[model samples]
Target: MKPLALTFLSASIIALTACGGGDDNAENLTTEQVLSLARNTNSANQNYPDSATNELLMKTPEAVTYYLGDGVLRWSTETQIPLYFVSIDGANPPQTLIDGVAQLESRLGDIFTDFKLLTWDVQQYRDTNASDENMGNDTFDKAFFMAQNNLSEGGMILSIDSGYYDKQYSNNAQNMCANSSIAPFSGALQILWDKTGYTYSKENLIWTNMGNNHGCKWNTQTVMHELAHGMGMYQHFEPQFGSWSDGAFDVLATLYHNAPGTKWADLQVSTL
Candidate 1:
């Protein structure tokens, strides 16, 4: 991956330094203040796992619980999971994507009393010269850009863009709708939507595939699947309802049945 742009890093340092005293006095800061500093600093450094920096910035138990734990990082449902909708290179997010998120928010609200999914902001990035040869890099570029601009602090970024063809799945690009990291790294997560994939629609908030004859199509379930990854559901398990031949079982269903606790990583049980 390319290094985060130097100018962005410089600007981030300047912006964060303005927030409070430097790292030497971080212990005196409140949990929220320290979280803000750590998040911005991690974003500027491209979200790589940095135990040393995390230890330095996160002094409070609340901050440590929110950003670090025994296993993969998971979002605490006690606070709202901010979702930032991003359109890259002028490719507007599809209506389906918007509706799907609303549906997710509703379902999650019903599932957890304190957990809320908030539509924090809608943003646009003008990467007019982005190339398909490195689509994953491009996705991270948009993520880092949003992070540096302070638009996605301690949030999940969902970016919609056209012309993304994952080379690893080149033969089935049309069937691949979207992708996301399995969990938050450095207190943030990212999701990339491929505008060229299967057409999606919703009826009664249940997403259905309306395009493509092969592979799984993009739908609300797909969003949930990818978002499950963002929420730290990493492993794929056997389908509960139907055979994989029909693309019936999804990560979301598995998560729904297995997630009985507040911690998402707890879903990694022997049942799956």
Candidate 2:
């Protein structure tokens, strides 16, 4: 709600320009310079005034399939970390999103040493009831029901498709959503990101297309950003940089303003 925070959101969510070969000028810029662009909306700061803003830019909405009934496909690693993969209308998550999470976990190393994660394909499951039209917006309600029906305790669900993703959620931006709630009793965390739009709901996890080259170069950072929220890193940290007029800031601001780097790996779970 702060001016700087809104500026961060505006630059992160709405204003973005795709670069040639998806590289932009990032190849030549340092980490600090990129962070500068994310903080400033003025075109003067960037060579490619039309360049995409921090993190992944959102794609436009298109027709997508969905699974009918509410159910979840669960999987885990050799260590037994519960990982659930969501599907809608027979459409499962893209390998890129799941793989990205793996990559992030590996990068975290000791941070999530106790947490090993992995997901299986819906094709391997026989009980899945695929259908379109059943899953829509109001994802919060659906997540509550899914948690009661699937997960006896409560957890998170990642969706590759199905939800209420439009300009309203995106604030007319192009990126999708990755919303979550810190409260456990409120059902489970719902995430939504797909091919059409990238809007995430707080109750249930729903998403569409995800993979390498989908958008942005900070896939690992984006994954970590959402997951950290799951661990209750919901509030933003405003570290002083310049004058008070400089505006708002948060500890996780880098997730939106910069690409994946050592700074992320440097994060301590206790700090969250």
Candidate 3:
């Protein structure tokens, strides 16, 4: 766990030469006291409960209909979840990269049986906020970034960072493949693609010189993995799924039922 990044608004008070104009109660408290009171009031209003979808999952039985993001927890026949690709590096993603994501969209039905491929609407954009090149690595920084750049509700962001001297990913000469975070307040998930050049092979899902390999093995699979994290499959290991299995075995394990061939279902209920 790292330190949370927070932007504290500076509290100030102007001394008035005339004493009778201000409210008597405000005059009694110091500037620090006033700020403390305001922050306490705000904190008291926050609800710590998990999102509704998460609550339902906790109380309901295992089902094939579960989803991975806080906003897009369950796919609806009537509506599609909006998925946005944000270029935090300020470089527009090439067509090959875009095509890879499209392929994933095509395969969602096969991957998630009850989920409809049509339930997700997709788009790409150059981020209006700071690029990944300048963003901080902590949870609060990531949360603030999403708050500034995210476009809509039930919307997920796939962010691309320029991977240069990133404190979280690029330390010790390492390149982060990708990372993700969910907003505690909103349950929206943001997937961060870091470092490694954006160069990709002509074929879809193959990134040359990117994310720990030239091919970026199972590019779609990796996206699904990170998306699962955003959706609340927070655990990092499972004996049935493999050492570093993304807990896909728990909820959507049926999709890959034969692989690793362990009869495990819904790690969410069992573990959490």
Candidate 4:
């Protein structure tokens, strides 16, 4: 349920802001800049100075809703792409990734609806190692499932393709593009690189090493990030809009959240 003429309306509104208006939210582009007045924490970077109360920033404007869930994107409408999530093993629940999906559907019913989850109570989905050679094939399997269900070209699926999303999957929609025919949003999809090991995960959060040193705890964040790409972020190349170290939230990073010590504000459902 996409908004009515949302593209045209937003474009005109953005043009007005360029000419100047009451766009206060447009002022601070960096998280550090966001909390310039608040006393901050030892930053992940000198310039970023990670703040306790800092509003987590993103790489894309669409990411705002992506990372923050449907509740946080200020201008989000009642329309959204109905996503069919592929809950693989590594990115499962009680760990935040899978739990976050249900939460989003439960809370942000306006933008997302029609929730269906695959319960692998017996045989857990494969949690591929970070270096699996068949990573691409695994993603293709999920794509095949969607195809079997007759998922329309416009529908979306969370493809835990290989750790790197540089390959094309033919008619499958992934959130790896900056203006890509697929997702196009900068921060749309996360090609997880085991934040623990600091390298790309062949499973891309689709598999878990039982909480050893696998990936970031924010699995759901990655899901929404890619969803934003499908929603049309169109760009993730802004040098100044990623980390406060990089600068501020842009279309790319906006797909995820950065709030500290709290997942509440990050997972609320009203904004999606």
Candidate 5:
């Protein structure tokens, strides 16, 4: 979400391990079978949305996306996961974050295709803190972002290169709001560069961190990952959703769930 369009965070650090919880041989099955299950997104007919409602749908993210192997985005009423972002690095609007949002917007059509992403500015709570001169040039207030965004208990916020750890703000990113749950969305975080730059993680984001070579596809992954979070799949391809490890099948996987040499991951989960 910061100015730098290309990003580098960590994803491989948390190698997702599959337990015997879902299927015993599910892991050992041929790539084809796995691909099929992952692509499924319940292709049931969605009632024609009213023109007014459809106009609004054009603004929000989708449960499934065309770029995500042809799955439509879906959400259940009971589950409302909100993600907020705090920009502290003087980055009013993160270009990289914008690119990611746009990539998804492209595939889903002009409706939600080009919706304006969420963003807002806020200041630290403590009046003295906000006005303090010696608090260093690295002052940040996560609580303000939360309150501005109406963050709830389970709500999440994305860090658009807020320079969180530049000083004491590291803890701020760790805890977006007071007692609120927050997670970082980043990619492969190399140590040396991070020391000179910023730390990144793949858990919170889905973008590929190829250093100087991040854009388009890199941003695409971010869109997929963030949107998945918007849905209900919080973890990366967890086995809890029976035969749902396939990214295309599960809202979480998306682009990262593809095979090494394949152009686009197979998202035909039990094709309807």
Candidate 6:
């Protein structure tokens, strides 16, 4: 593995502090400064640090319950869902990827009624029409696969691969940490993970290597994030008074970072 990049670590800290609301100095910043900071922390950059603090936050009873409750975004009708992990063009999804899904399922499950993961196994789909240079084909192929299978209940098709496409796969300039179809309620949802740097697998698909420290363990969070989008949680582009102040820590942001006090359940009305 390459030596932990200190520059990446610094960049993540700057981005998170600017929008995560963890910094005490955030209150002193001007609106212009905050907007500028928000723009900087946009989805384009997926290298945000996943610190230990974030993990602790997720483990808290309130945080787990928040996601398990009816408030968080999800397919309202389907409580038990099957998430299919796909490997495009013969690309193999590591065991860590499956482990990440299992971890997510465990996190959302409880003694009482809770979110259940029906399928965690990876299914291979060969996109013969896909080109190494064109990422759009991957998107098309994923949709094609979903259509062929008639996936309607709930869940998402998550593809993990190392493609020869640019980091920016969509109109947004975001790195290919992951992207989804943003289907909510009763539509097809797909998520793609570009394993170009092997960054995700190295961190077991959960955490990022920030020097000697573990940055954001977004593998599970990324799964939940994409699933949340599929469930109808829209990205917060502007600063909301009671909700997120920026795109960095939107409804899904609270899941990835250490924000225990945020009333995420109250942010959006539950479709359930």
Q: Per-residue lDDT for 128-184 in model 4, tens only?
A: 453321122233343444455555423343433212222232122222211111121
Tens-place lDDT per residue, model 5, 143-211, is: 554455454322334443221121123222221111101223221121111111111111222211111
What's the lDDT for all of these models? 0.31, 0.28, 0.28, 0.27, 0.29, 0.29
Model 6 gets an lDDT of 0.29
Tell me the spans in candidate 1 whose CA falls farther than 4 Å from its real position.
Answer: 1-73, 88-93, 110-134, 137-144, 162-164, 182-217, 240-272
Tens-digit lDDT track for model 3 on 1-272?
Answer: 22121111111110000001111121233334323322222122123333554554455333212222112111221233445444334455445445444543454433322221211111121122434332323333433444455422334445433111233433332233443433211112222211121111111111011122111222444444444333223333223111123233233322222222121232112111
**What stretches of model 6 exceed 4 Å from their correct place?**
1-73, 88-93, 110-134, 138-154, 162-174, 182-221, 236-272
Per-residue lDDT of candidate 2, residues 1-272 (tens digit): 21111011111211111101111111233345334422232211223233333221333122122211111111111222334455434344455556545654544332222222223232222112322111122223434544444643223444432221234334321243232232211212322212122222222232222111223233433444444444323322222211011121222233322222223323222111
Write out the backbone clash pairs for model 3.
68-231, 80-119, 250-266
Q: Where does candidate 1 clash, by residue pair? A: none
Task: Give the alpha carbon lDDT tens digit for every residue of 172-241 in model 1.
Answer: 5443334443121111222211112111100001111122222324555555444444443332222311
Per-candidate RMSD vs. true structure? 17.2, 16.1, 21.3, 17.0, 17.1, 17.6
- What's the TM for model 5? 0.31
TM-score versus the correct structure, for each prediction: 0.41, 0.35, 0.34, 0.33, 0.31, 0.34
Runs of candidate 3 with Cα error greater than 4 angstroms are 1-78, 88-107, 110-154, 162-176, 182-218, 239-250, 253-272
Top candidate on lDDT is: 1
Off by over 4 Å in 4: 1-27, 30-80, 88-95, 98-109, 118-144, 150-154, 159-162, 165-220, 237-272
Clashes of 1: 0
Q: Please report, as a residue range, the 10-residue window in candidate 5 with the lowest summed lDDT.
A: 207-216
